[model samples]
Target: MKYVLEIENVSKFFYGLVAIDDLTIKVKPGQIYGIIGPNGAGKTTLFNCVTGIYRPEKGTIKYKGEDITGMSPHKIAQKGVLRTFQNIRLFKEMSVAENIMAGCHTKSQQKWYHSILHTPFYKKDENKYWKRVEELMEFFNLTKFAMTPTGDLSYGNQRKVEMARALAADPELLILDEPAAGLNENETIELTNIILKIKEMGLGIMMIEHDMDMVMKLTDYITVINFGKEISQGVPSFVQDDPRVVEAYIGSDDEEDEV
Candidate 1:
């Protein structure tokens, strides 16, 4: 398989508390990989480590065959790895279009002086990015709400706006934390469609989600972690049937008595 991201023996410690334990994983290009675990299972910590939020205590991370371990978050993002938080993080007062435009800042070449003076190149770049933003808004079906304040939109639409903003970065690997949180059935279905559309666009995705139905339907491979250790990794159906996985995560009703 053509791997886009690789993590080898990665581990993290917070003042001697182990958050991730020698975690190793790979995400192939254009594949939707799911990371599922109970709360405090170190899933978010793993995401943080991969995205440069925290440097791992050991092991290495590579992207496109280049060592990216210990890089800054901004640098990782520049290398085409972008992530969204579990909590919806939008500029409450900013218009939906403006919020997306903000995400394009890293790719924008218009310097402060050029932006202030409105130089020809600045105008050209601005127009180009604006057009791209419009395209993304349309793709996510948010064009009608483009001018609305992000905080005023419904919870589901706000989540869509977050996805659109993430797309504005044109990332090769998108790491989403609970994108389906706070959504109704219809919204969840719509979000699933958006995720599939993103994968079809050839972007590799690694998502940490608790919704098994969504994860099973959307992911090409599954990795389950419990108490900061990965218990299983394989195709969804195979992982679902693994005895260790069931024991660690999906406990049977009768097994609850033993616990």
Candidate 2:
């Protein structure tokens, strides 16, 4: 299978403290890949590196066979890579529809001069993007809140808005950082359905999540990291049974329960 995102021996450091150390992983096209680890295990750091929030100190990252190791965030995003933060990062003052519109900026064809002069092409593009925003809002079941301020929505709704915004970019590979964080059980289940829907749309996903139940249910493959290094990786069941994975990540009690 063709891999959508590939990282080989990638490492990153902050003031001499290594956050990710010689880590390697790959997400195959159309797969829901899971990255699970304890706090400070560098899961978010890896996401940052892939999304160009932080440049790795070593190794290479390739997206669709192009080297993107040190590219800027905007450049990487333009290549169809998008990520959400562990904490919901929404334009609080913006309406839900406006927040989703932000992701369409890269795909907009209207020039600054066109916007300044209100050209016909600019109006046409604006209409097209607004249609897209509505489509995205409907996809996430957020159409009712389209005109409401983002800050007025509940936590789960905010997360849905974030996902909708990311989808507006038309990304091929979406990296989600703890998207289920702060969500209720029903909301998490809803998110799982949305993720699978995205996979059906031919988008590859790499998610950093702590809810093992949700991960096991949604992921095609699992990668476990501990202390900035990959400990084990395989199909969910295989990784769940790996003893080293249990000792280093999943506690022995959970291992026994699985057995």
Candidate 3:
């Protein structure tokens, strides 16, 4: 089905403690898949496995139909899989444009020697990336702060900049961890619209988030995990109605019978 990512029966452990167990997910082109669960549900761990931050001990991770299980993170990224963290991970002292340009190196064809010698190949490629960087900045509404240090921008603006940097890699699949965290209602709404625009560009998205309203509104499908197990998965409506979801996140009203 033109899947961009296929994860099957994946599992991970930390000192014999299972962090993810038998997890399977398939992401197709232009799909926005949501990963939601309560705290400590191994959502981030799953992202790590997919992105190669932490290798899965079992099963396979396939990107673009190639097995990427345990591949180095850079190799995975070079294959057009990119992600953003829940915690802001921008270069605080760098200008907004510089931070994004850092992500463009992977796309350049010029070698370090060419750059050092100021060869035409290096300058030509450098100019192309500069234009592309401006395009991305304008696409994400960061042109006004192009020369500003990322740390000087507002929290919401900083978040946007981080996302722009990730997109600078020109990925086919974007994995976002809590992109809406810490933003006010207005900022969240803006972020929502921005995500919609990204979807229009035909990029598949896999996101780990806690904002129920955002998840309900933006995701085409939802995967609910708890304590490293996939408890429920489907559209938002079914996930919201699933009893296991309630028990895992909202807690159950019924108590155990007396032994």
Candidate 4:
């Protein structure tokens, strides 16, 4: 089957230290793929390479059968690929609705002159984007916080805003880095449901997360990486049972279980 994203022998390094060592992965549309590993397993590094924050030292990356290796981040994002950071990143002073509207600017039709002159077309596109922002905020349960400054919202709500912003870009593939990092159980569960909803909309979702229960519930397939190498990968059930996965990451879950 044709894949939405294909990474083949992709490698990256910093100061001669390998961050992604000949790693390969494939993601299909409507699939939720998880990347799990220890803290230094090169998960985020791989994301950086994919998003063009770092150019890969070797190998190829193809999206929809088109090679996109080493493209600029904004250029890549324009192609319907969007991501949320492991650390929450949002405009602290921007209203929740305004933040999401910024994401839609990439899809806005008016040119610089139109915006500068406040032309009728600018007004039209502005209204269109505003309506879109409102719809997304309402969908993510952020309607009440629509006018609130993003920094003033609770951490969980800020995260939801970020996801909403990413979705506002109309991504075909969404990459989330450690989306469940600091959430409480209830918040995590809610986030899980939201992610499932996104998947149902047919976006390819990839994430790097430490929360095993959340990852296991949300992902269709998972790849385990340790020290910049792939040690295990498959459906969640199979990866959960693999000895190598146990030794590397899942074993920690067992320890948490014991505690």
Which candidate should be chosen as best, given TM-score against the real structure? 3
lDDT of 4 at 164: 95
Question: What lDDT does candidate 4 reach at residue 42?
Answer: 96
Which candidate leads the pack in lDDT? 3
List candidate 4 segments past 4 Å from native.
250-259
What is candidate 2's lDDT per residue for 22-122, written digit by digit as tens?
A: 99898888899999988999999999999998999999999999999999999999889998999999999999999999998866767789989999999
Task: Give one digit per residue, the lDDT tens place, for model 4 in 135-201.
Answer: 9998899999989999999989999999999999899999999999889999999999999999999
Which residue runs does candidate 1 get wrong by more than 4 Å? 250-255
Per-model TM-score versus the true fold: 0.96, 0.94, 0.97, 0.94
**What is the Å distance of residue 92 in model 3 from its true position?**
0.7
Q: Which regions of candidate 3 deviate over 4 angstroms?
A: 255-259
TM-score of 2: 0.94
Better model by lDDT, 1 or 3? 3
lDDT of 3 at 214: 95
Error of 2 at 150 (Å): 0.5
